[model samples]
Target: MRILLAAAGLVLVYAGIVSLVSPGEPAASPQPWGFGTGVAVRPPEVSLSGGLYFKTYLWARGGGGVLYLRCYVYSRYEGGTWLPTPEEYPVLGVYSVTVGRGPFTEGGALNLTLPLMGGCVPVATPSVDGLQLGSIKVLAPGANLAASRIGLYVAYAGGRLGEVTSFYGPGDLPPSPEDLSLPPGQAGVLLALARNITAGCGDVSCKVERIKEFLKGFTYDGTMDAPWPHIPPGVDPLMWFLQNKRGVCVHFATAFVMLARASGVHARLVVGYMSDGPVPTQWSLTAFSPHAWAEYYQPGVGWIGVEATPPMGVTPPAAPLPRETPTPVATTPEAPPASPGPYQWPSIGLGVFLPLAGVAAAALVGGALFKKRVVIAVGEALRVGAPRGFWVYVNRRRVGRAPVEIVFDKPGLYLVAAGPFVRVVRVVDYRSMAGRAFEKLLKKLKLPPSATPREVAERFPQYREVALLVEKLRFGLRANKEDYRRLKEMI
Candidate 1:
């Protein structure tokens, strides 16, 4: 009884921690489309030019897996409020890249000197120069009214794939007109079913069961398959339905509304957080819960909810603890002593195992300690006049914002700074080419090679290191003359 109670207590503790650290199960309500996908690193440009352009450069790529890319642009008219730019209808053409096997193709630059005749229009200006994708809604396309919002963002800008060159003004935008329309019968049937479920299902427990029943009829194993048939990329519930039957509540809600409408049910999908837990205090990582469910109008219960998906399945990963009940594995017995050795401290195997165990423990502790130190150090650094609202670019790619200190694994010349402000620092200088040259110059001045420009400035703020370096190089006329002569001779 004691062991069982202890196990139960541990399980409860673990569940609570997970809920606190990550987001809880979604509430039965509507939510905005949280399209989370990796975008390619836009090539390094000194700055963005003011005009309409195709912001394409391979958004997401997975090994042998279908890639879904979500591009966000913030746009505004000069001297006007931020206008919501619509999402784009991307038409992809796969080609083979010569470097390796699979569909990798040589990409081209996004030229913007042509007429833009697509649905997309340029939101950038001299002062207002960004894309506004906040209100841009992306939904699964279908015949139903709800799915109608999931139309092509803008139409194709350039001509077909390779011939694509320039972009005109968000040229004559296309209308939300499609030939394949949904029939009234199908839409009505799905809406009716949704209304019935929303009206009847009262609580989370009841909704979970309802989802189980709904999905059981579709998938034999109750596990969904992938590559949803007849659905557009990134805008289809059918994609999740066909992919993994083992998705969480979001998958169920999406699929439920989609399938219902397909089967002649008048239903619309909604996205919102479930009112399960208390509201968060701040917009921290824990506050963002991408929840989704559906609601339909019923005669009896106003706008009722049909929770096609409830919270279930594997939980998101966070800080983990050891299992309450550790499973024992079979082990081999120690060998007998070969000879009568006097005063043997430990066997070879025991010595090896104990040291290794110590090392593993130390490693775990070291990692935690290191993380704590870094976080604290960064906090301190940020407080000391750390530039705010600056962009961070590494290897000519804008990866993050400032005040950020990025520790790169590979050593090379790394460009780090906030937007518009930049400093090129060498991550690793095993070659010692630049550093050695600078150090030698310092040594000739009877100073230690370790006295770098940054160090000197810290010691005496008035003597700007950059200015001093410039002066020193200026004084070394013979060396400079020799370098100039070499260059002149080469020319």
Candidate 2:
């Protein structure tokens, strides 16, 4: 036994050594989109142009499985750009990040990269500034969510903050609009250019192509320089971008949206992720994937992605042009208000097993911890006594409202809530009750021999829950009113 224990100790020591030497961040394999497989090192600039990927852990329906869903945002397209919606959608999440001043993407430093819990896509100012999502969670009735495989990306300047981004949630689908209207704007440097850019284009298709061609001259930059030394006070930034050819995806996308609008085509800036992976339904993103782009909406064609900034290392699959554009997936119109379908319980539909890839990454990245060895037997029924009403809570769900007994096949920490009272209980024989094993668990807790289990439980918070378990396993005693009374007194 001593030798076996020593061997186990040595194995633990080896594991600790390996963990210490490994990289702190999870690594990714070379992706089709251009993200390199490597351990990410923080970059010097927030606007370091280009893409990166991150890993994520996703759970659906409370760990039933992954809910295969496409998470993105939509807006009305007119004047060659996306129009902001009227309804303000509040992002629901626990934490928020701050930068120099506000939620602005270019807020700099602390505010540069923001972490998000995915329900819908966010609209960033410049088209290229996009998110490499770390976790994508879908919450529905009777399900759970989790994330894994976290990687870092160079998240930089895709501007525009506090704009309303909309999603098609649970509701009857709305009619697809064929066209949109342009907003009123002052005529300046942009008017003449817009006229010329769409001069010969009589149809929407031709006009859209011309705008894309005009913006092709622009370059992608992390910190895009102002197009010229001094801009006329009234000239729009998009006008300046046209005058100056150098900029990042954000610069190019912004230019496209404005220029398209100027040309009398319905247009809007669309924000979403740009990853090498064609379908994001199964994967997570990194900072490198946060991107902004332009979209010209066609009533029947929907919003098609316009590629203004050419990809640097990898080219992702492009949205087909208006004529050849494929219907975007998850156009699964929200279920109609009165349309009835067969009722069924929601099940886990992880489009793929993406989380399995992160197990090794998590082990290497997360530090080791002491694991308590336990032997539990299944099918062992513990007689639960409750004079008043009680509810047994295991893994966060209330199993039953108890006027009677609690039979558990799995052993772990449990809480029994009755009236305004609650007590923690532990059962030893739960998983596999094949053989009889007597344990001196109380002694391991280092309580004095004279210390009654009840007294130890009352005095020490840690032992309170395990007290019953120790007595049950060691002395073969069933929990009774005395155990209940003692626990109730301590609480």
True-structure RMSD for candidate 2: 25.2
Top candidate, metric lDDT: 2
TM-score of each: 0.22, 0.34
Shift in Å, residue 182, candidate 2: 6.3
lDDT of 2 by residue, 251-288 (tens): 57667766766676665554444433332222221122
* 10 residues in a row with least lDDT, candidate 2: 106-115
lDDT of 2: 0.34
What lDDT does each candidate get? 0.28, 0.34
Residue-pair clashes per prediction, in order, are 43, 55
Q: Tens digits of per-residue lDDT for model 1 on 1-491?
A: 64455445445433432332222222223333322221111110110111111112111112221111211121211111112223321222112101112221211111111112122211111100111111112111210101112221222221212112111111112222111123333445445554565457654334434544766544322122321233334433334343545444444544554444343333343332222222222211111122334433222223234555533321122212111112111110122111223332322244323332333334333432011111111001111114566544332234444555443322333333343333434333121222234445445555442243433444556545442443233221111333333323322
The residue-level lDDT of candidate 1 at 158 comes to 17
TM value for model 1: 0.22
What's the residue-level lDDT of 247 in candidate 1?
45
Root-mean-square deviation (CA) per prediction: 28.6, 25.2
